[model samples]
Structure formats: C-alpha cells, structure tokens
Target: MTEQVMAAIDGSQFSEGVCDYAAWASRALDAPLTFLHVVDNHPQTAEADLSGNIGLGSREHLLEELAHLDEQRAKVAQEQGRLMLKAASERAVEAGVVEPRTRQRNGTLVETLSELEDETRLVVLGKRGETAHQDSGHLGSNLERVVRSLHRPILMVPATFKRPEKVMIAFDGSKTTRRGVEMLAKSPLFDGIPVHVMIVGAETGDNRSQLDWALTTLHEAGHVAEGEIRAGEVEETLRAYKEQHGIDLVVMGAYGHSRIRHLLVGSTTTAVLRKADMPVLLLR
Candidate 1:
C-alpha cells in the first residue's frame, strides 16, 4: 500500500523519457513507481452507405466482416500496450528503480486518473504525446483537464530527460507562489538543489518585497535560495532568465492572479509549458 509515483504513458514517442524521469523521482523520493498505460476505448464506427440498394444477405455479411475487423484491431491495440509496458518497465528498472510495476487499464486517460488518484504520490506525464497536439506548439488535449482534476503536483516531462541540477520557480508575489514555495520546501524531491526565486514583471517595490518574503521562507525551510527581480512581460522575461541561466527545471503555479485567464489554454502557464525545453513542475 505504498504511495506510488504514477507515470502515465501512451506508447508514444515520449513514453520512454517519462519512465526515466519517473524512475529518477521514485529513487529520489523513496516511492514505488507504477507505469500506467491506459487503453482508451475510442469509438470505432463501421462504414454504412445507407443507400438501401444492397441485398439483405450481402449487407449482413459486410456487417459481420466489419465487426471482425474491429475485434482484430482491439487485439492488436492490446498487444501493443503490452509491448509498450514491457519496454517502459525495463527502462525504469535499468534507470535504477528498485521494482517498477506496470499497469494496463481500459478507459479514457482522465477516467483512469480519477480512479487512480488516491494511490498516486506524484504524477509524471509527457508535455506532448503522439496526438497530444495535432498541430505544433499545442499542448496535449488532456493536459489542462488533467491538471485541473488532480490535487497533486504534476511534473510534465519534456522531450527528453537530463538530470536537472538547478531549479527555478516563477515568483509573482501571489498567494499561489507562496503555496508553491511551501510545497517545494516540505518535499525532499529538490534537496540540496540551488533554487532561484525569480520575479519577472514591472520591478515595483511590492514585487521586490514579495520576492524577499519568498526568499526568507525558503531560507527558513533550509533551502539555498536567491531572489532576483526582473522587468518585462512575465512569459518572455521568465523564459529568457531560464535560458540565460541554464535552468534545468521550471516550477510555477498553474494559475496566477486571474482564474479567468487560465480557464482555457490561454494562460502564461501554457505559454511557458509550450516554450520551455525542460520539465515543468506545475503546482495547483
């Protein structure tokens, strides 16, 4: 009954890296790792001309053939799931996870997550999956809803995994940012990592004051933290800072001052998530 770090994979290009990051978290946090592959029961329809010109017997035969094909496709999908799970599990084990477990469930990804949320310690998912976005620069369709559904901190894995050495949290002096600092402080996942509390906005006195407050809280929690205030647009400034400083991980609250802005895919969070070339730890 140990809490598990749940790694959701879709047998897509990002699945392997997802497992590797999950393995790293499991080892670092001393939690069991579970790789979950959800067999989404998407609807499949048999073609129908509906012209009513065919004989009954021929129509029946065609319907039967269609059903058989559907069954075959389901079997093939299951086989692929098994193979993906096997490969992901092997990768996790090789990455130093003590005993990684694999699960193949049948449902939509969101439904499966709702059922498994109670047992999850941390959730790791790819920023973009195979069909995550049909177009370039779009987040996975399920990403927003998944973040909304879970109360846990989600670590969105990017295209690849490099052992993150430096971690930075986007600070805006909001209540959510304060909560993020507390969450990071309470967890050992970022132990001994130098944390850069960065604020990107109009460099007002209040902004500097908030940054100092964040710095103090992190210090009280025994973290090596520094506060820096920059002036510019939030997304552009933070992205520039991350790249300029060679930041390995980016942490930020999923929502900032306005809930309306983040209600859809039109938020600074999404912009950073889409642009950053590294893992993003999104706190709700």
Candidate 2:
C-alpha cells in the first residue's frame, strides 16, 4: 500500500496549523495526505448509577434518560467530526494537497492511529490536542502514546504554522539520534534546506566525533549541513540555539533512553514539546 502523511485534527485552535503543516509535509514527500478525525467514545454518565437511596422506578427512569442523553451526545459528536474533516479536506486542497483524503473513525485516537500506522509514512499532530486546555502547556494526552506506539516519525506542531526553512536536530550520540541522522540524510523532506546538528553537553572527544560523523553523513548526501557541540542544559541549549539561528523546525529523538533513565531523569522529548513554540519532528 502507498504510504501517506496522516494528520490527526480536532475542533481546536491548532487544527488549522495541523492542516497547514500536513499539506507542507505531503508536498515535501510527494505523498498523499489524509485528515483523520476520531470521535472518542469517552466513558459516559450512563455507565454510573449515581442515584443513591432513590426508589427503584425512579432510578430506572433516570438511567434510561441518561442513556438517551448519551446517545444524543454521540450523534452530535459524530456530526461535529464529519464537519471538521470536511473543513480540513477543503483546507488541504486549498494548500495544494491533491485530492486529499479524510477519515472519521469511532474510537480512541491512539487506537485508531495504531491500526493505520502501517500506511502512514509520517504523522502530523498538534502539540496540545483539544482535550488539553490550550493555555495549560500540557502535552496532548495522546501525543506521547502515539509517539511510543508508532514506528513512524511524528511532527508535533504548535498552535500556529510557518513554512519551515531551517531545521535543527538535537544530537547526543545515542543510537536513536544516529539513526535519525541517517534517516534525514536519505529523506527528501528536508532536501535543499539547511540542517544544523547540535550537541548539548560537555564538549568532549566523543561529542565532537559524533558531530563530525553527522556532518559528513549529510555532506555526502549533498545536504547543506553544519554541526556544533555546545555546553549547557539540554533543553535550554536547544531552545537558545533555535532562537539564535531562527530555526523553524526542531528534529530530535523521542524517548530514546531507557525507561529507568527516563523515570530517573525526565524525558527530553516531553520537556521540549512543552516549551517549544515551533514545530518538532520526533524520530523514535
């Protein structure tokens, strides 16, 4: 089956940005675009009988009414999802996605994406989804799960969109980041765009060697690439470098460390996503 750039959108402020970035990625990869909307079936009040010490007849009547209300809510949610997908499709067409596709599923977002992961070359999502308060700065409830569950690269974009010009990859000589460099070398998604490889930590021999290896790999691939080893906190250094260089996109490894390590020291991927104002393409 042909691979596609799958974009998961919802009725949120970030939906427009998701469409914009999805369209850009589809064109960059020369692949088809798909807009997916999932009407999540959250646990409903009908499942709980909260009427305590009520008459049997009254309790039954309340339960029936609750069930009816749940059905009505489901119908409204389905309709809303359909309209969202239609708008996203039209937006994609306007943004130059040729004959974009849309799918509305009745399930949880993570489960739906996992089922369609095989056909997805890339996944585009909002930094914070509709379930999260936009001002709360919390990562989308499903973002971490999707990233961990799927094997494809996931692009998590902010509430706004901007065509990426320069991209920076946060490197730390890990096996995952090495594979990321190799993937970037072969992928045309960032072709003709400048790539900067940044290593944040003590500037040591290993770090220099890793940085050199990355640069050489990109150079061999005919990419305009440069690398540097900086000394500072990982997240802070990455943010400063991105700001100073005006990088529009940040590419990095997601949850590459061991579970114990992540538990001991929080995951850099999560930290970056929380504070990032630009798009982040995470390679797992």
Candidate 3:
C-alpha cells in the first residue's frame, strides 16, 4: 500500500500550518495526503450515581432529555469536525497536494490515530492544539500523548508555515540519534537538502568518530552533509547552529522510554521543541 501523510486538524491556531507542512511533506515524498479530524466523545454519566434523588418517571424524563441533548451535541460536533476537515483539505490542495483525503473520527485523538497509524508515513499536528488555545504556556496535551503512543515520525508545526530547505540532525551518540542518521541515509525525505550533523556537549574522540560516521553514511546515501561537534548545552548549541547556518528544520530522536521522560520534566527533546521556532521532525 502507498504511504500517506496524515495531518491531524483540531481547528487549532496551528491547524492551517499543519496542512501547509503536510502538503510539503506529501509533495516531497510523492505520497498521498490525509486530513484527519477527531471529535472527542462526551461522558454520559458522572463518577458517582445520582439517580437516587428522582422517581422512576422523573428519572426516565431526565434521561430522555439528557440523551436528546447528547444527540444534538453529537450532530453539532460532527458538523464542526466536518467543516474543519474540509477547510484543512482545501488548504492542502492549495498548498499543492492534489485530491487530498479528509476523515472525521469520533474518539480520543491517540486511539483514533493508533488504529490508522499503519497507513501513515508522517503525522502532522499543532504544538498544543485546540485545548491549549487559551493557555499559551501549556503545551498540547494530546500532542504529547499522541507522540508517546505512536511510533511513526511526527512533524510538529510551529505558528507559521514555511518549507524547509536545510535540515539539522542533532546527534548525541544515542541509539535514537544513530537511527535517525541511518533513516535519513535510506530515505528521500531529506533528499537534495543540506544536512548538518552536530554533537553538542562534551567533545571527545568518540563523539568525533560518531560525527565522521554520520557524515560518511549521509554521503553514501547521496546527501550533501557536513559534521560539526559543538560543546555547549543541547538547546543553546542547536539554537546557535540553526541561526548561524540558516537551518530550516531540526530532526531529533526520542529514545525508548516512558511517556513522562520523553515529554516532561528534564528532557532535551522537550527543550529543543520549546526553543525551536521552525518545524521539528521527531524520530523514534
């Protein structure tokens, strides 16, 4: 089956940006594009039962009213999801993706995407999402959760959309970082784009060796790559390199670990995400 770039649209501020980036990925990879909108289901009952206060007839009437209200809510939510998907699909089309497909699902975002992850090569989403629209400080809860649950490559969009011509891969000698090097070597996702492989923090002979190997691998795969071993903080070094070299995208890896370590607390990946103003293509 042909791989498709699946972009999740929640009508967030980043939804249109997601579509624009997704369209770029679709064209760059020569793949089909899919726009997915997930409608979260509302709860039908509270944690504790409250039926004891009403008689049988009254309970029945109340239940009927609640069910009717839920039905109408379902209708409105579905229509809203449809409209969001339509707008996203149109954006993708305008961005150069011909005949993009749109899907509207009902459930939690993670669950819906988990089932459809097999057919998707790239998953695009906003930084936080609709829930975080009010709070600029808080990241998207669904974005963090979905990233943990899915094993596919996720392209996190910033506030604005721009196609990246130069990409940077942060190599830390970890398995995830090495895997990113090899993955790029075998894939055309970053074809024709200049790659800068940087190793931040301590500068040892081993780190130099790793950078040399990465450059070799990238060169073997027909990519124009340069290696640089920087000594500083991960985010700070990356920011300097990105600004100095005009980096358009940052490709980093997440090691296999629990959700808490990957998305919260003291993770370098989280820090990089917070600092980067450009698109980040996260690899696992």
Provide backbone clash counts, one per model: 0, 0, 1
Q: What is candidate 3's local distance difference test score?
A: 0.82
lDDT of each: 0.81, 0.86, 0.82
Give one digit per residue, the lDDT tens place, for model 2 in 206-233: 8888899999999999999987888977
**Alpha-carbon TM-score of each model against the true structure:** 0.91, 0.94, 0.88
What TM-score number comes out for model 1?
A: 0.91
Q: Candidate 2: misplaced stretches above 4 Å?
A: 43-49, 257-266
Worst 10 residues of 2 by lDDT: 257-266
| Candidate number that wins on TM-score, 2 or 3 | 2
lDDT of 1: 0.81
What's the true lDDT of residue 76 in model 2?
95
Off-target runs (Cα >4 Å) in candidate 1 are 43-57, 134-136, 259-261
Candidate 2 has a TM-score of: 0.94
Q: Output the TM-score of candidate 3.
A: 0.88
lDDT of 3 by residue, 94-179 (tens): 77888999998888888989999889899998887776745544567777787788899998888789878899998877777788
Worst 10 residues of 3 by lDDT: 257-266
lDDT of 1 by residue, 1-284 (tens): 77899999875677877888898899989999998888765732335555356687788877777678768877887888889888888888888888789998887777788898889888999876665554547788667778888877789987578988889999876777789888777678888887899987777888878888888888898998886888878899888888888889988888886646556433888889777678898887
Clashes, model 2: 0
Cα RMSD (Å) per model?
2.6, 2.2, 3.3
